[model samples]
Target chain A: MTGRGDGIRPRPDAAAAYGAMLAEQLRQGGLAEPRVRVVVADLLDHVRTTGEDPVQAFGQPADYARAWVRPLSRWRVLGRAVATAVGAVGMFAAVTAFFRGGSWSARMSVTIGDLVVLAVFALGAGVLPWTLELWLGHRAARRVGRRPRVPDVVIRAGVMLLVLGLLFTVFTAFDPEVWEPVVLGPPRPVVFVVGMVVAAVLSMVRQPRSPALPRLPGTPERWWERTPGRPGRRRR
Target chain B: MIVAVVVAREDRESQWLKGVLDLAVLAALVREGSAYGYGLLRSLAEAGLTGLKGGTLYPLLGRLEDDGLVRSEWVTGSSGPPRRYFFVTAAGRAELEAGRAGWGAFAARMSTALEG
Candidate 1:
């Protein structure tokens, strides 16, 4: 079978190809459709049986049924708003603590610089994986059986980066002077802007596909359930 | 069964498995003299060491042939199919010999250590 360049291009096997594409789109669209949900479930079942990448055959689903849908409760929105307000106030307090000096201009510069550095750390750590994990988690969860476990590697790496990002942000916020080399150095604003542009470009590029899980010689025999020839036969 | 499940996602252990490919494939040929893809696959399955996937096996066999450890010939079988049968080369025999010595030493040491 011939492969196309991008976007799940149609193949000679039009029917199967179309079905896979449509099923994927439906999966992304909240996975609300029972039939499409079954298709996603079946795709996962095949992965469990054949030990292949389910999305390798298609692509990321459109609606991402396995993704954590935001809770519909009004309480969730209210709670989030309250927490965000608290965070905003804490951030103001942090900035207030940093700039207890006489000169207004100098304090503004330091505060703005601190905010930029904080933004870098959060983007590098939080925002990047927060966006990525939604899709990654959904894919990992749907790769197996009815009860999906978090893909350990993705979970571990994401959490590690987030924690490190938090530490970096906290450190940079408290000690804005540490970033003085870049902030006060020549072509200051140019450096920050260039860095942001480079980061945006890098994030846009598709992450490299990880190597396939190693396939052992005799594993498939154990993966599938065995059915007896006679219905009532005693078998372990 | 328990070990297989536990080690399923251990990538380091899987890389180590790659190091054993030549030995495993060579051992299969030593037992059968020569065999085709499905034949070797079945032999491995019967040996209760199964997890090999398609994306891995075919390319590995190609690499082995390229390295001259094993040579392949296309022949029509009684099953009405053209199959590529692989036979171990002299180099393969040498590699197997070295592996045997290493494995023997490792097994002996482990046995002694474990018993103690």
Candidate 2:
């Protein structure tokens, strides 16, 4: 069958559109033809209302898992590692201070900080499995476009890590005998500033190209026409 | 009168050809063994099925493959881009012969009906 000039038809590269059309054609030939008609109608509805390629819409869950979920998960792991390293150093400091006849309160406080850092690190580390599951699951779904069963093992593992991190933080914060420090070394201003700069640069790097201005699918353009109101006159 | 008869004959054949094309494509693959998409499309056009677009042909090939009547494999052409080539299966060949028989029966019945 030939394509009608219905705007609802997907522009060929949209794989989901291609799949839906194929499904309709096969079902019509072999099984109930009305079933194919209903599917085609639904597909047309999806296209007309959303202006989204249906396949791509189904792919949003995978995309979200990729661009946001996996990254956040990994960053949380990295945070845990940073906390652990800092805590380990605090532990060493506590031990040294204690040996040096440091005040009971001061040495004890550093020891507590060490414990806090380690706990956070341990909790954060558990997120790795969940991150891995999300990544692999998304990749598989993209290839086949079939519903994938989310592994309970991965989910439980992720929950376990989060709980562990929370428990550590709670215990450290609430303990009575473990003395808490008034300040933890220079307020971490340098780390915060550096982190903000790095975060800004990363955000800038990962920004999605606006899809409003359609580019050739899966290919780059030779020249870009800058939208009006942008800096600098158009250059060849 | 002769010119009018020729024109009428051409119109009837064109109308008949249009309906048979969907089957004609299946017959070509069943007979030819294998064909590249563009090559098959061009050949069909040369045989009088004209105005077929690249967009229409590619999707049809994909649908045929999906249905298992046709199978495709990607091969890198000398041009360096991969093109999907299609060949009919045993079932497809059987279906083509059945369709051909059905077409002949239908044509005979229609001719008798029209004459009556």
Query: A98-186 in candidate 2: lDDT tens per residue?
Result: 35453433322334555565455534433333344334533443554454576656766777787778776777677665546533432
In terms of DockQ, the best-performing candidate is: 2
Cα error, candidate 1, residue B96 (Å): 1.1
DockQ, all candidates in order: 0.01, 0.03
The segments of candidate 2 whose C-alpha lies over 4 angstroms from its true place after superposition are A1-236, B1-20
True-contact fraction in model 1 equals 0.00
Q: Give model 2's docking category.
A: incorrect
Docking class of 1: incorrect
Question: Which segments of candidate 1 are over 4 A away from where they belong?
Answer: A1-236, B1-16, B78-81, B113-116
| The TM-score obtained by chain A of candidate 2 when compared with the true chain A | 0.31
- Evaluate all candidate structures by whole-model CA lDDT and list the values in order: 0.47, 0.46
**What's every prediction's RMSD, in angstroms?**
18.7, 19.1
The per-residue C-alpha lDDT of model 1 at residue A219 equals 27
